[model samples]
Target chain A: MENSVDTLLPTLDDGIKCSAITSTDGLVLAHTGSGATLDEDFLGAMGAALFAFGSKSIANLVGGKMKDIVVEGEQGFVKVTILNDKLLMVTVAEPLKLES
Target chain B: MQQATTSISAVQIAHNIEKRRLFIEKPQSQAHVTNMKDAPIYKTRPAVLQRAQNQDRTPLLKGEPVKEVKIILAGNVGSGKSTAIRAISEIPVIGSDAKAIERNALHNKESTTVSIEYGMAYLDNSNLHIYSTPGQRRFDFMADVLCKGAHGMVVMIDNGCRDPLNEMDYYLHQHGRFLQNYPGIIAITHFDDNNTDTSLLDYSTYLLKHGLACPVVSLDARNTLEIKQVLMNLLLQIGDFKTGKKRA
Candidate 1:
């Protein structure tokens, strides 16, 4: 199922730009799409680190669990969603139509 | 042999013995000495050493003081952008609580952002003020207005959605031109759901291809330490810019 998800990722219309299945540990289980070399292992680790930081911040503030996190910049946008205990999905897209 | 023994006569033997005794008994001269007894005496002068130490350390306190950093968070809706801002803000953030408002004649109430949310936090004694603008398209003008004088920007994206990259393109379209000279950080959020092959480095490469000169960090807006690290990196970037400006 995981491998199949990985394959389907590259096929998700080019508008999707880039996609990755990262573990709670920030490990990149799979990725699709292109343009630029991405280090899956490092991103995976960093992803976990990001999750821990975000969750801890919210917890410290008594805001409860983190539902999702997003970041936008000139070049593009990055969205992080907590899918389950073991997985997170990260998506990158053009700045246009991101809110939609 | 007996005649040879006479060569070292009683007088000469007595002279040698006397010379040895004098060499052994006489104290060493003080000219080349380090004055071991005076060493402890000098140690007793703690006040002088304290003053010398203070003189050596006093110069560091005389420089330009730290300036507060202003951070502006700009992004599209559902990018978890607001949550990202809330994560690092030290003060209470004023934001909407998922309420719907009517937009037009259709009477279609939407959970739109009514007012801007602002918060502040301190990063290692340096103040950081963060603002979250409405993510709706209608608020683009407002977003641009709020983003006008920011020292840095944190661009967020949602990874679970189908067309996440469009958010990046939209940001570039609306704010990229102005931010061309600004230092920014790209944060990829929502890593727990969608399964894709793209990596953060790949996303970073895409940004660089679009002519952005900054670091791309994979971040979960809910994590505090991760957010702090990102902020730290941004602060370092600001420091670098100041240094470059001073040099120029």
Candidate 2:
């Protein structure tokens, strides 16, 4: 199943440097792209933590479901989207560099 | 719990409002109330959710405001996990109770935690979400689910129970990693009835010997003042952790 996820990442936009599927427990199941300089393990753990925090905070405060979370850093951006009850998809990418 | 009352009427804060001294030891609270005309306006109740809605949402990545803190209560049957919550919770605790079964029936007062218990307290506009884990081991699965992302925990130990030191050991062993990841304290319940060969020092000694430094305190779970002390201690420890102070 992870192999299937790995096969779908190259089709993303050029700025989409890294994409991976991670379990809710912080385990990286599959990966593609390389815009991220940090280790995949660290990236996966971070994705899990961010998702968990976002989901729980929203659940308790807003009392609503969390659809997705986007974290932007000076270096790059990390996007986490829920894929299923037990898995989330994280995309690490650079800014699109506006056509200005 | 040892103090389980069939009718919570006796423990109801609305009825005991006059009786609540509101902990003179509780800093800022006395002054805050006195400056507000000395009339207690906010009757500790469920409708008052201590949540701060005015958080700066500067995009998703910069930072997220801490609207509340989650704390878990872990202990065995009759450790007063239920009563402590009732005594201190500003809101009516939301949970079910059932008649005790098996060896638990011998523990005196009936009823077991049917599910997670929730209570809340407001501190500096941030909500303190208190959650109680069921005492039965069969409910371990539920404990895992309830404990995730909790900022800290207060592990209650019925010191009068058989070999309470071992009980403390068991709980810490079960959650040592979790506590290490977060701040936690040891609350000795049933201290008045404690007839054991050990004292508070013994518990502290043992924790120190085992390389654990979680603060230990004697508290009557039925007394709101003592419960607040325990909560305040844990809160301070969490603050200390944030500021790089040595763990208490």
Candidate 3:
């Protein structure tokens, strides 16, 4: 299962800094990163927590399961997506630097 | 983005409406402050008692062969949330405890719950699934996740802490929405560890002043009998909430 995150890494663009695949129970299965010093455990736990609550909230309010959650901050973005019922993927990426 | 905010705002509006309804319509029960130990659990509500007797107390999962009741145990680090579950659970607890990266330590404990802990106990006719959240504020998202569809909340506070009242206030505010709809109980731990001046009545009074008519009791989380008492009280409180009967 950890290979799932590694397999997806090659397909992502250059802006991606790190990525992790975590169980729904918040355990990190696999991770791959190059640009940032990522804490895989913390990332996995936070991602699972966010996805669980986000999915529930969306289901209650919008009448459907949430596919993903994208949180934008001043420094970067954290995106969490539900890969399946039992797993979720989290990615931390830098903003696209527009060549001005 | 506008649509998302609107949907969230609608939920907030509905929550506020429910709060207002309870506060205005149930003034006698909502405003009353009585000693929980002395008060009868269901003095006036026979329907709730009958329902419990029939094993129809609110189930976490509906249409299941076995009735599952979800309860969330929450508190600060070293407040004994995990220990309480261990004491009461019939099976081995599934814990996500890990070493703390931060230097700050409470109760000289090095490791803490990183995500969630789970335990299970079978009561007369119901299977109780107990879930505990990590105590750190950074892991608060786990608490929010566990709060969904929960039957009740047990907030264990360490009495020996420097500012137990402040900790109580923080937990109450953090789970205010859940408390508003479901029953909540404050279980004070570590009372013997320190001779704190704050009495149990003070906790009850604080809760009443803050518009929460929840029970406050002291117990050693490691003691199975004491933990059972707390859960029994919580079940009674859940019954009270369901029947709209306020504890007198």
Candidate 4:
């Protein structure tokens, strides 16, 4: 299966400028295609915090948990997706529609 | 009566504990003290045992960049593996040394650790998960399982045990392949009662002779302060290894 960290993140489409697989504790397990100017460790840590915030906020406001989070910046977007309770995948890529 | 400047530091506490251990180890006229060979294999001090019993609260480690440092404590039977874990663990250790009932048993002797001993020690934001490997060769299967993510190890050698040097060699031969990646320390226990003129230098020499290297220090299993010192040494070694500093 492709559930392992190395296989999971690198297999993502080429649109991802940077893809980091990290534990829920915010430690980077595996990372592929680093951002030109972004710090990988700091990105993983902040992505973990952002994911926690999104998870809790959705749980409180709506009635369920957050599927993923998409933050759009001037240059591009960052997506934090929870792979499992113990693992998560963070990807930085150019703007793209969710359905597309 | 107002005490502000006359407070005890951790170093002072450690010094006091060492002094007490030295006093207890002194050759006295007391019969029971001299005849400890017939006593049980493990004798944890009253204070250490009480501390182990009282340790039940979860240490606060949330919202921090914590490094999960797993350390495996391995040695022969009755080498005080479990005692070391309990002495340093901030939480109540998961396993207790029970009387053994099986022969062709773990150690070909009485009293074995049928399972692994689990403990945790927290240093600032770095959290260490300590596992005491069962001493019997029969339980060698548990080595890989226990050492899954061990950052380092502290091997306890009982000077009182028969041919402790051979036992030490056995451990080195068994785990040296994997343990070379990280730093380790040797804790020579029971030297007080065993009194074979064994020193930390003896262990260091053996390791050097075998081309294996690590720090060797005498340890009093009953002293929590001494156990903490061993842990501090390992943590410092880890820090040195991580920072690419020169290692002794």
Question: Which pairs clash inside model 3?
Answer: none
lDDT of all the models against the reference?
A: 0.58, 0.67, 0.70, 0.66
**Residue B137, candidate 2: C-alpha displacement in angstroms:** 1.8
Name model 1 segments beyond 4 Å from true.
Answer: A1-100, B1-64, B96-112, B245-248
Q: What is the C-alpha local distance difference test score of candidate 2?
A: 0.67
lDDT for each residue of candidate 2 in B9-115, tens digit (9 for 90 to 100): 33332422222223111123444543322222223222111211223334333464545778999987689999999987889887645444344432675666645
Give the winner by TM-score.
3
Off by over 4 Å in 3: A1-13, A17-91, A94-100, B1-66, B243-248
Error of 1 at B203 (Å): 1.2
Provide the lDDT at A68 for model 2. Answer: 95
Q: Candidate 3 at residue B47, lDDT?
A: 39
Clash number for each model: 67, 0, 0, 0
DockQ-based class of model 4:
incorrect
Model 3 reaches what TM-score against the true structure? 0.58
lDDT of 1 by residue, B1-248 (tens): 00111233456445433422221122244345364322111111233223222313223346645468888777666666667777777788765432333334112334444336678876644678887766655445557667767888887766655655666667765766555556676676766664554555456546545555445556678887667766665665565565753211
Which has the better TM-score: candidate 2, or candidate 3? 3
